[model samples]
Target: MKKLFFAAFTLLLSLCSFSQNYQLISGDQIKVSKYSSDLDIVASDKTGNYFAEQRWSWNLRAKLYKFDKNYNDIYEKDYRKELRGSIFRGFYPIDEELVMFSTEYTRKEKTFTLYARKINKTTGEIKQDAKEIGTFPLEDKRDDFEVKFAPVSNGKKLLFAANVSNKDRVSLVTAVLDPQLKREATATIDFRFTPKQFSIQDVFYTANEKIVVLGKESEETQVGKRKKKRWVFKQYILHIYTKAGKKEKEIPITADQRFAISGKLIEHTDGTLALAGFYATDPKKKDLSGFFLSKIDTDKNELLLTSYKEINASMIGQNYTEDADDDNDDDSKKSKKEEKKKDDDDEEEEIPNDYVLKSVLINPADNSMVITAEISQLYVYQTQNRSGNMTTYTTVYSYTTKDILLIGLNAEGKVKWVNSIPKKQQEKYENPNITRSEEDYFSGKTAHPYFSSFAALINKDKLIILMNDHQSNNVNPEYGHKVKRVYNFKKKSNFYGISVDLVTGTMKRKMIYDNSSDGIMMPRSAYINGSTILIPATRVKMFGKNELKMSQLTIK
Candidate 1:
């Protein structure tokens, strides 16, 4: 199988094409011209032939648009006035119709309600009135509320999860529905935890209509001869349920060397589920040193945990350069000053093990899975001033991204191969002085740098990774690292696709789309539909305001 994949990767190299067959989906023609922000492309079906998008207009008006396979505009409707105080969640295209869900937040009453509407995909006509599926009361104030409504789709079935938090407990209410917006069943689970000790990692809706929840359980214990209380991060708690919300299993996985970091939950082709994540090596540290995969066998009422496999940092991408002194800067240094400088340069940076596990792609053809994540770190700085007895302190936050890693796992959750695609990205921003809304907290600040989130496109023969590269035109081949930062309203970015060989772990990057000078590409809104990649971009228009355009990259 590996040989066959390698051969296909080699064969695709000869057929490589960098020229983009651009399609301009002008906002003007589609009645979505007001705002270029919040653009996204999603397919209604698995074949990627039909697509739809829900975006916000310049006046904060939410609208929906649909398109055919050839990128032709079909319908566009604005629902801002109709769905007041509501934010668009997601949409599902069923045959010739569309189901759109939005979460409405009532500030005065401090409440949230899930609403759904059906529309004709071709005519842009709302076929059904906005129906309230469920309403949830907020425990926190409107300004401090942070919980969000999560909606997921499994083939033709739809599921929605709304979280309500009290003093020390959180109630998760999940509802299963059909394509017609009919509720099938509802499940509610309560999680109790001590503040700052335990946290929920993620909640997923599996294809088999099960609710799987992953969370961290922490407790303090005595270790030293002094018997001092030491906080030991406990095991990961997995709560799995049936479609009707009955608790089926509770698996407490013991952490190996360090605390486990939970990622995505992948549903296998054979009805089993795989929980993928990494574990830190030291309890005192937060860096990941090993990868762990767990399988929840509902049939046997058994939870299988694989031995933690150490991750080879060398397999990471070239975005980071080694110690500067490792290179011969003059064979001999006679000056004492030069020798001292060389010694200082010899100090190498220890890359952190913490990575943001973004996605997991399953390949049923060869019974393999590809896990994707990026090395990221948050740097916080503080400044203090003291005058006599009075003192003041200020805090700032910054983020950095290093190389991306891809690991291939077999059916049994064993690591088959590993590879890295190197790139350096960073953002300079200050901590928010004022409180933000729940939407801002969940969607991230739009002013920050936008990075592509999809792990990789799994082709029959090779793996395709899409990333942001500001220096694609003048990349340095000698070194594997490049640094770019976006501060204030100034940003420079380009999209690059890296192709990796499954068998040999070889990597090659090609320019997918470049922003002409001052423009920016919105990667969060980018979507991979079958063999094509679609993303929205903002370019400088006449009045210094930006004009919205869509870039479509076809994959052969």
Candidate 2:
């Protein structure tokens, strides 16, 4: 069946028409603000109780939202004054107390200081009586620094990875902070850099307490050299530290070719690290070259499994040829003068089909990790005559394309297997007529491009996969067109969710979210206890959006 998709956002114009609010009843969730705020939600404990957050502002404040087991808002307080620092980074809820640290920059002395605090669960929000302790910023110029927390064998401790000194080589500094907010700063773990190149962008910690550093480096050029130049690319370095802050072992990447990089690290109970990120090829190889990566590694830095295999895009490009020809017609045929003018004025190359293809849990396992990515396709094609011979001269066409990437690494980092969700098997193989013509555009089919958003849980023996399909502003918003050409794709938002068996790579029946007359469907949020699920939901409505509500779903 052919479906209509458009952006008839004629009514959602009023700003006060802000969307409704939702709270995950069974999980620790914080409603930042009714309209806009820096942080929607950040750190939450395993049991889904107490959660800490960093407000999004230039001089933002850190707040804690402790919800009762029933999901009632119990306490709301601020901690900006307690730590007495201009800035704060690492934070989360723990046990019966809330433990967090602070870092500040002393502009006058050009120095940095770190501090910490342990508040009772009932401490009441950021009170004047709230006692504070521990300085983490280490009285030096920690120009480039970051702090994080991880589960340590002896107990949970803070892991600070920053520079040892502004003048010294950049190092990964570690400090252990327990529930009591006690500090046992480990010796600095340094990540060696290239000659005259030293800087780290960001870092993450695994369950086993190993650290993965991700960032780029740059080198200066000499005056008389083969033209001074500047190049930047991402690099990865792995490190394990002792309780005293000394290095236990280090594994560094030896890829001679460096390109821009951004990545995340997750820790597994079986002591392995799951890494998910994307890389690009040279600008000249844009068409013949694209990028894709999926890998699992042991805690010790051994490559467990990887899917960097190239995706032959020949089929995709060929589809563009047949489709492109449909744009021109015999009625549009031009005389010699008209044809020659059209050829010379033509600047836009023949565009190719762009797909944001991805998958999850390629190798499902009890301890397998979930990795998701978005690969954007951008391509162009041009034709050139092979020879100048009048009659035998044949023309050939070639294309150039670029891939933009975005990745999300699960909090725990590892999953049983990545669900290899396939792309649409050519148009005919896909559900019929999901695409429609653009009401506001020239002659061309404006497909309702789908962005697959998923919510997954790594349970004891299974990987619960909740998938949602969104039209993501793919087609143009329908204007005042009679048939809602542009408006066709506008309100076409239908959501779907599913459950999967990680060990067997299997899926089950699903849930669908429908839209309303006002064009809204805030679907429901979910929580998992053992194998049971309690979902806060909104039922499908015929003419209006559903009321904010809740329900339960059983997976047998």
Candidate 3:
């Protein structure tokens, strides 16, 4: 009895030590508004105050709620009266103020105006009326105008890029705004490429106060010899411009004799830039063979370092070996040739495709970087039903997010370690002939991509990857093990966090919270503030009601 008691005590001590590494603080469950279909915690302040947005189902207006540091409700404000007819963009939390951006299109003036409204963080009240910051003229009322806003300088400034076309000429108007939503500098850039030839992939406001525009240009060019040539080619170009809109430099990203796809640009704190992405040898095929990382010195117009690593079978835990037959007999040779063909086929199947760069993390202390990419694909199924001369067609769309790849690189752009976490999450959407309710259609309750993907939080020593998975996966010894697929994440799912050592590429998977007892977590909506990771959890009750809570995970 004494031996058994001592063993039980040891087990309990170990459990306590494991639990101390992570503290899960569950906020009190608050009753969601009946009229609101979706509730999401959008922003948080340094003082631990949480701000949530409750979106109405019937209209475009939204309500904002503020909770104290302890998760107690403080105040709620409905912006329907003030923001009527305006399209909501997003929330930008600056120091003590929360700025909301909206766009209004004036038919008479044929202009689209960007407006900003500030709300007091503590009082949860609108500080002033909407202020128009910038306006762009359109050729017609139906002309396409898109505005993309990104917070730079740690949410102290905003970068706005407007893709406007007039008279078949496309131009990008870039602007920088201060914390008060005041324009500091603006510039219009005309790349001289036709609207169909060039497309803007992303805009970055660098630490050096310069604007970097990443664009993709597509052209039809023959690749192979005269008879086997193809005409489909794509290249990515980077345009560096001063804050005042003056064009500084243009850099074209390319790999020798390879097609660069899904390229991403990372600007380090020291003003150096890195271009990283996957590459495919054959443009006609969708499979990727390797990834390349290139560091550039923009000021000197020189490539500092370039490294390429192939996706071999060993990297993904697959084995490929060519069979050899030493016998001089013709039958042995034939058998060897057949075995070699089979091995080649197996190796080709091991290569993964449909991967997009998800996130890039650079250590400020040493500039060591980590790149993450995920496999995303969409499959559609169509079915026909015929009943008594009436035929109906049904379409189902299956979206899958799987296999996250993590590559760690040293300060000199050399890859140190590579690992992949295998997970399969699928969300399906079916088109119905009958009309659905606004709450059911817009709430994303039935089919939402937010719960299908994963989120990552990185520190100096470890990288924590969060995702929803099947409950059975919690018992797996480590990541990359064969696991069941997660379907209908909102109804049944388990939240997991896989912590990876930055140097060794070792991983430890832990079940953070189970959705069965807690609430369904939206991994994409998770935000990290300092060492604490905040995620919003929601449980749908009967009659379209939602029970909302906040999950705060503090890394000890």
Report the error of model 1 at residue 451, Å. Answer: 4.8
Give candidate 1's whole-model lDDT: 0.56
Instruction: Please give the lDDT score for candidate 2.
Output: 0.38
lDDT of each: 0.56, 0.38, 0.66
Best by lDDT: 3
TM-score of each candidate? 0.73, 0.53, 0.80
Q: Tell me the tens digit of each residue's lDDT in model 1 across 442-525.
A: 222232334433336766556777656655323423234444432211244565666666655566666545555424556655
RMSD of each: 9.5, 15.5, 10.4
lDDT of 2 by residue, 1-556 (tens): 1111211111111222121111222222223322111222323444334444444345546676554444455566677566454565545444345555566666666656665555555644432342233333434544424444555532355445444434445555655556665654545555566423655544545455545554445445432234545432324444455445455555443232422133445444545555544333432122423233334443455533343433344422222112233223221232324334544443221111233323334223423434444333211222333455544422211111112121222334332233333211011111212222212111111222222233355454444554333234222112221111111212444433433444454544233334333222222134444444444323323454322222223333
Residue 447 lDDT in model 3? 20
Q: Point to the candidate with the largest TM-score.
A: 3
TM-score of 1: 0.73
Question: Can you list the residue pairs that collide in candidate 1?
Answer: 288-353, 317-422, 318-422, 318-480
